[model samples]
Target: MRTDYPYDLAISDLREFLARRVTHSNVLSEFQEELDSSLKRKTVPMRFIFEKFIKYTNEHKQFVPYTKDEEDMIDDLFHFWG
Candidate 1:
């Protein structure tokens, strides 16, 4: 069936795929691009997105590994929102 919420389904599916592809620093930027124009969200925080990515990568092995150092850097960069 054709639905008006393809972007929503795509985002949910992409989130799973992104768990295996995106690097640490690109998380926020990717999330921004994912929702930009295609979808609308209510002010999702950097920390929220970061934590979700972190949880995803933790559960699976990614093609792009997110090292501990990069994680710390992301924490510092977004700590205000964290």
Candidate 2:
């Protein structure tokens, strides 16, 4: 049998693939776009969606290489989230 949650599955799979292809930032942007589109058709809050991405990315960091400079850049961006 096949499944319909391909987007979700892709997100999970890509998290691992990204470990070897950290240079491919487009995949992350595509995932974010799909997530935003899904939320736009429902009652989900933006904050919740943002948190989900943040949490997943953090949890899977072991699979991806995040340099200290990149971490600092993220921290700076997070400061403006308010």
Q: Which 10-residue span in candidate 2 carries the lowest summed lDDT?
A: 1-10
Q: Given candidate 2, what's the lDDT at residue 70?
A: 45
Prediction RMSDs, each to the true structure: 12.5, 12.9
The clash tally of candidate 1 reads 0
- Using all chains and alpha carbons, the TM-scores for the candidates as numbered come to 0.34, 0.32
Off by over 4 Å in 2: 1-50, 58-62
Best by lDDT: 1
Per-model lDDT: 0.51, 0.45
User: Candidate 2's residue-wise lDDT over 1-82, tens digit each?
Assistant: 2223234443343344433433446656655565556445532223543465566666656346556754553343334321
TM-score of 1: 0.34
Question: For model 1, which pairs clash?
Answer: none
